[model samples]
Target: MSSHAPRSPFRAGAGAALGAPALAMGVSFLAFGAAVAAAGLGTGWALGASLGVYGMAGQLVLLQAAGTGDPTGATLGATAANARFLPMAMALAPWLGAGPRRRWLALPFIAITPWAAAMRVLPGLPEAARLRWFLGFALVSWLVAGLATWLGLLAAPWLRPPLLAALLFANPLYFALLLAAEGRLPASRLPILAGIAAAPLAVLLPAAWGLLAAGLLGGTLAFLARRPWRRGGG
Candidate 1:
């Protein structure tokens, strides 16, 4: 009788696959923590937000609202900022492909970076290993983000505005580069172009509204542009 190697739930490549995105998220969260500290929210609250909310945009919204001393507005703002996750969940549903309980449990780990990384990596992974890899990747990413938040909060006292601005800029730059890496696809071009064209106009709108508008317009244009190609199988 021949024996086969036992199946491993974890992939050797899983940890390394998300290293760059995890580092980028850590830096972004470091900036976020500094911003929160500068706002006088303290490290505990910042770390708590990292663990509980795990969303940079929503945390920023909460901080902004707290500054205004408006609890209701803060709640609404955070909700609106996090509204993007709903569509994100829908988009990821097919990729996750598991029992409801498992997918539901993993929902908290969903974020822009993880979603993008998973989209790029999961297709190549066996179905059984995908969830495990995602969970492991997300855990490491979350820990890095949380630790960076703590360090940033501690270092906030010494950081200057320009330095903090540069730190904050890293996240967007990383995301832009990620998108550019994927821009070889015809479907991506129209949306990227639309977003660029819409940026100035978006800036004139309220912050949340502006993001929503740009995404909707850009995504709509991309969808329309892709229809013909998709139908033609080209």
Candidate 2:
């Protein structure tokens, strides 16, 4: 029999991507909006950042850095955080359509996030389905965030800190809920461990460096730890 894997349920569940993933993106965008407003950024600027940067974590980091009078740091931070997109891009490459489609789709990849990528690569999905799921997930993120940022800026003084905090908090909360639902066996534990370890390290290490380390270390450890299919094995 052919060894080709069956289609991923998560991919077919692209509909769900429009749900939870969209909600998460909206919440994060709202938070980013608040932060930008508080920092005295104009609505145009906030929206521009969302459209251009598309990375909630990176955007937040850049804004914080900018608030501290370090545009250089903000630039560096954004760049560093964006570096993680390379692996995600590679994962997504297979599902993308040919030629200009791949190149065009790659544009939004700049804003790729763990949740977005995870939703796109939903296990057990077919290639076409995975592509659709990813596009939907990414589109929702762009729209929701752009709107939220605009709203946050328009509201300004009232929404800044709390909304930003909520947005930041929402990401992990969403992940935890998802993990709780999906994390039953030992094999699934590696991502959970890496997720737990990632945040604190992201805060400690230089922006994107933390993500890179976690991905490498967590992936390597998981690979090494795998055995037969009894309890845990790939």
Candidate 3:
């Protein structure tokens, strides 16, 4: 580890959290808990989704699919929903340094919130401190999610249709805001803007395919726009 590394990067990471993204994730987990209860699954199932699946979109899909008595399909759907993380993890790979830091223990915690935070700040940090910082941020996020799930399940009986639906919608909406903010980076901005523009078109496609289509189309356009010949034009 470099001497420049903060002795308490993990603590610093912990302190960096409990913020807006955490709040958003909390709200989403609340929705997940409510969904769990509504799906006729119990408290353990809700907590399992939070601690295990960890991804909100995947958690919701897991709940729905699990209810259908098709475990294999449920697993596949949930796995597919969280496939976005593969790229995110890959992007963070270089910052994690070598050996264990590049492996399972730290990588499991790379959720959207912490990943975005890492992109904003990790480049400025000591390489030795980066994983600790991410671990700290991610642990706080994980706890917030778990607590929120408990509360939401407790409140499930009272939350109604429109409200529940609205809560369910909140996570993805906030994720867009995260992406828009990430767009401040010159490399990420064009694709993010393009994705935002293509979002409306996503509605015209099948629910599952829409977002995927929007992302691929948007990212492709952004990549083209940034080509050497089209540099200033982008």
Order the numbered candidates by lDDT, best leading.
Answer: 3, 1, 2
Q: Which regions of candidate 1 are displaced past 4 Å?
A: 1-14, 228-234
Candidates 1 and 3 compared: the better one by TM-score is 1
lDDT scores for all predictions? 0.77, 0.64, 0.81
Model 2, runs deviating above 4 Å: 1-17, 67-70, 97-106, 109-126, 181-187, 194-208, 227-234
Error of 2 at 89 (Å): 2.0
Q: Per-residue lDDT of 111-191 in model 2, one digit per residue for the tens? A: 544344554354556544555555555655567778877776666567656556776787767767767655665666776
Model 1 clash pairs are: none
Worst 10 residues of 2 by lDDT: 7-16
Backbone clashes for every candidate come to 0, 5, 0
| Best first by TM-score, ranked | 1, 3, 2
Reference-based TM-score of each model? 0.86, 0.72, 0.84
Error of 2 at 159 (Å): 2.2
Model 1, 221: alpha-carbon shift in Å? Answer: 2.3
Could you tell me how far off, in angstroms, the CA of residue 22 lies in candidate 3 after the best superposition? 1.9
Clashes of 3: 0
